[model samples]
Target: MTSNSPDRPATAHPGTPVRGRAHPPRHRQGPSPEEGELLRPLTRRQIADRMGELGELYTRTTPSGRRKPPSGRPFSSDPSALLAPSPQARSAAFLRRLAEHMRRPGFELLVAEATRPSGATVLTACAYGFPVLGDDTWWQELDGHLPANLPDLAAPGGLFVIGDILVERRVRTQDQSRDWNLARRLQKRLLSDHTAAVGVTLVDRGDTDTVAALLSWGWRCLPSADRRLLVLR
Candidate 1:
């Protein structure tokens, strides 16, 4: 995708070195009605179709050789890896500009996380008034903290706005299988619930193959758009 600014260079190109900590690209302008028309409305059946499409894309685009490091590595184990400090600073700056575009009142922000958050990322989300939804693991820990029954994926009001997509891949311990059916289930539920408007930030162990395998299940890999919403500075 082309950067809106003529002066800025494109971030993704063939043979670019992979940064251990890459800042998400800037957000493209919100999808126009024409583009929105292209996306099927969120429905359980449609969600399944999208998931299949994503899975096929992931499998086809990612090769098996590009596997991520083992879970014991620093980046793989640390939740903070989801947010690089330098990228966070840039993201904060971007948020300021984004706020200008969100002039309508009563917009509520939600930050979805697949695992426990780092102190820094938590602080940042709080600073921005974004409600945190710690999926699966976090939900289990804090489920008691929320209401007895959280509503299904329906946006509470038309006011729901996702600030970022956080992808967290769970490592297989000795007892845990490498299978990712649970992750795929959660991903589909969220996507179907939110429609395709929510921006997703994929946080994995930098395993392109494994990540691709997960993405193949139904996740969209629009890094550029994610960068715009999640990365601010």
Candidate 2:
């Protein structure tokens, strides 16, 4: 599914077709809190499928013209990339929809971003009872530098051990072999320490390999899911 409308001016008529805006912001009405909890403990494949659906929804509603390649293929520098009227709205809606989907189950949402604004938006959503974890330069840091200060998610009874967890790992570049390796290692470590449900969001600029590697690490692949995680090298 994809959207083809253009960006709407801030003061445009309410009835105007907004480029990336969902008619009612799906989160406004989603699964009840109890249902969210029930959905929280879903398998990796389930979570991926859910996220994929949200992504499809975003693409469906986002104007094709706005899908421009990044300058020099660099990560988008504009904060609006994560929340503006075009792609931002779709992205925000994706987060909101995910939150709503997990709201009923009280699943904790962990979003890791390469940029500050993306993390901020995810954290903001997390503040509403969703569990959020983030790192600035997360991709760079995860590539080779494992943080000594990293939280002990594996600690028994730690905050990291939450039923139904969503971990978003956003990638902006193609040279992510080291990062993928580290992420797989970390996932192995986390699985050993915690029994809570876990899922990952391998957000990429366009390189499917990045997402593919992440999924192949341990996450059960779901054809129904849109994102593909490749096995880390």
Candidate 3:
């Protein structure tokens, strides 16, 4: 949704190297270890238990790859700053929204995990959403007229709202670029149960990068007066 940005985190390019961490040596001998495997959908309780870790993932994968320092302090130079958890207030607010959304009927949450060669499982990506009810309530939020064909997609069996999709950052090389595709898979898994339903989400009007990425992924933009309304059939 526009309030949350796009499904995928609008972060640094996954292929960019972070200043503090050393890139793991790649083993071209077999499949890459960073490739994520979809996990079973999570329940609200499971999400509660892992909220801290999820918050870190959200912070680390943000546009700057680090949290903003409080108003009076200078940015930290500590190497660990690159992997620091999100600021408490911001993280709490984000988790609150996730929890609130989970309360909606038909809500579904999916997370993808990848294993390091060292055998540690890491959160790779996440996506969650619910079916939109067959009513005019949701459409009334927009300022302009809806596209003619769009309403058909929102009929009884046709619309699913993709609340958010988040992906973690990883150092990458040409041969181990698989981590970048995790967002797509998370979304695909999110929609797997809703056969023939069109997926819809919103993005901030100024978020050109996200809009470009969605367009590249085959989602088309529907005309809207303010925020962008994107749909995937």
Give the best candidate by TM-score: 3
Model 3 residue runs over 4 Å out of place are: 1-36, 64-89, 169-180
lDDT of 1 by residue, 68-177 (tens): 44456544555555543353344444455335423433322222222223523110011011222324231233224332223122134211233322223331111122
TM-score of 3: 0.67
lDDT (C-alpha) at residue 180 in model 2? 45
Model 1, runs deviating above 4 Å: 1-37, 49-52, 62-64, 68-136, 139-202, 207-233
Candidate 3: tens digits of C-alpha lDDT, residues 55-137: 77666554433455554787789867655454675567668878887888788888778677898987876778887765746
Better of 1 and 2 by lDDT: 2
Model 1: per-residue Cα lDDT at residue 114: 26
Clashes of each: 17, 19, 1
Per-residue error (Å), model 3, residue 60: 2.1
| lDDT score, candidate 3 | 0.67
Q: Model 2: per-residue lDDT, tens digit, 146-189? A: 33323233132222322222223332122224324333334434
**Model 2 error, position 4 (Å):** 54
